[model samples]
Target: MGVVNVTPDSFSDGGHWFDTTAAIKHGLGLEAEGADLVDVGGESTRPGASRVDEAEELRRVIPVVRGLASEGVTVSVDTMRARVAEQAVAVGAALVNDVSGGLADPDMVPVVAAAGVPFVVMHWRGFSESMNSRAVYGDVVTEVVEELRARMEAVIDGGVSPEKLVIDPGLGFAKNGVQDLALLAGLPRLGELGRPLLVAASRKRFLGHVLAGEGTPPPPARERDAATAAVSALSAHAGAWAVRVHAVRPTADAVRVARAVEGAA
Candidate 1:
């Protein structure tokens, strides 16, 4: 999956695509760079980020989603709102990538079920504004897996078919560097949940920290693409179904190489 943030404050490449034309171009570029799907989000869910009202989000995203779909691109609406998901699907979005995993909006599951589109249920503790405070965990990987399982059950009970579900461990959401590393290392445990996994560690802070060494300032988001690609290679080797990324080419190449190596093995 490729990310196209239509908001102005996403941690990475936010305002770059805030314009509908720019966003559509970026989405098309991602597809050309071998992204299987493009995920378009209107809200900025970065740490300490405030929420955008539904109306503003709709205004920012609908045009971009519609334009990309019209160009025959496979589009996923990255929204937690049932209404936005519904509208995006109507405009030809093939999937719903809800970061909240149906927690933020009560109507999300039913809407997804009715549309019969694939839904990405991420491990989420709270909204972005307060999520950092909720990062405490006994065993981060185990807790994330258990939480995701509970979310899966809830969505299934709400009428979404289990087969239509994909699980994301949510790398930076409510996770510190150590917890993030633990989750990545524990991908097999997460896979035991018996669902496809989506690894979205593209240009995240954890990767930056690793690249920076101790007591050094982490590199900026765009400069972390190489590290992101490295994670993509590892994640694909470990059996991730997809890696959501901002810079699609390197990850696209990395996953292919990983697949080739695995095939040879």
Candidate 2:
């Protein structure tokens, strides 16, 4: 999956694709670069980010989704709002990639269950505003697996079909650098949950943290693409269903190499 964050304050691109046209072009470019699907989100979910009003989210997202879908590109709406998911589906979104995993909105599960589209049930501790405070865990990997297991159950109980679910570890959402690294190392445990895993280690803080190697400022977001591609390679080799990333070309190439290696193995 390729990322197209259509918000002015997204940590990755910081509004590079905020305009509807720019977002559509970026999505198409991802498709051209070999992305299996393009994920378009309007709200910025980085740590300390606040929610944009529902109207603003819809206005930012719908047109881009519509534009991409019209161009025959598969599109996923990365939103937590039921109304936005519903409207995006109406306008041509093929999947609902909710970061909240249906926890943010009561209407979200029903909307997705009723729409019958695939739902990405991410491991979310809380809303982005307070999520950093909720990263506490006894054993980060085990806790994340257990939490995601319960969320999968809850989503199923809410009437979504079992066959229509995907799971994400939600790197950097509530996790610190060490916790995120532990989760990556624990991918097999997460995969044991028995749903396809979506690894979103794009230009996240942890990558910058590792690249900085202490006593230094982390590189800017765009500068982390090579690191992101490295993670993409490992994640793919470890059985991730997809890696959601901003720089599609390098990851696309990286995953292809991983697949070739897997095939040889």
Candidate 3:
């Protein structure tokens, strides 16, 4: 999966693709770079970010999603709103990648089920503005897995087929650096849930901290792509079904290398 943030404040490459034409071009570029799917998000869910109104979000993403799908690209609408997912799928989006895992909107599961498209149910505690405060965990990995399991049950009960579900650990949604690392290390445990796993750690703040060392300022988001690629390689080796990344080429190469190594082994 490749990320195309259509909002102006997504923490990484946000303003760069805020324009409709630019966003479509970027999605096409990601497709050319070997992304299996291009995920277009209209809202900025970065820590401390405020929410965009439903109207604006719909305006921002629909054109991009329609444009990409019209061009024969596999597109996924990255939104928590059932209405947006419904419209996007009607216009040809192949999937719905909801960061809220149907927790934000009561209609999301039914929308997905009716559309008959694949859905990505990500682990999220709350909306972006207050999510940081909800980061507390006894054992981050175990807690995340348990929470995701509960979400899976809710979505399944809501009429979405289990086979159409994909789970994402949501690296920075409500997690501190340590918790993020723990989740990455615990990928196999997440896989035990019997759903395909999506690792979305592309250029996240935790990787910047890991690269910065103690007491140093972390590098900017764009500079963290190489580190993201490294994580992509490791996550693929650990059995991740897909990786959502801003820069797709390096990670695409990394996944190939990891696959080759595993096949040889």
Q: TM-score of the candidate numbered 1?
A: 0.99
Q: How do the residues 111-192 of candidate 3 rate in per-residue lDDT, one tens digit apiece?
A: 9999889999999999998999999999999999999999999999989999999999999989999999999999999999
Q: Which of 1 and 2 is the better model by lDDT? A: 1
lDDT of 3: 0.95
Q: What is the C-alpha RMSD of each candidate to the true structure, in Å?
A: 0.7, 0.8, 0.7
Scored against the true structure, residue 14 in model 3 reaches a CA lDDT of 74
What C-alpha lDDT do the candidate models reach, one value each?
0.94, 0.94, 0.95
Off by more than 4 A, model 2:
none
Worst 10 residues of 3 by lDDT: 254-263
TM-scores, all candidates, are: 0.99, 0.98, 0.99
Residue lDDT tens for model 1, 1-265: 9999998899988799999999999999999999999999999989999998999999999999999999999999999999999999999999999999999999999999999999999999999989999999999998999999999999999999999999999999999998999999999999999999999999999999999998999999999999999999999878899999999999988888888888899
Candidate 1 achieves a global lDDT of 0.94
Residue 57, model 3: Cα distance from true site in angstroms: 0.6
Pairs with backbone N, CA or C atoms under 3 Å apart (clashes), candidate 3: none
Going through the candidates in the order shown, the clash numbers are 0, 0, 0
Q: Report the Cα lDDT for candidate 2.
A: 0.94
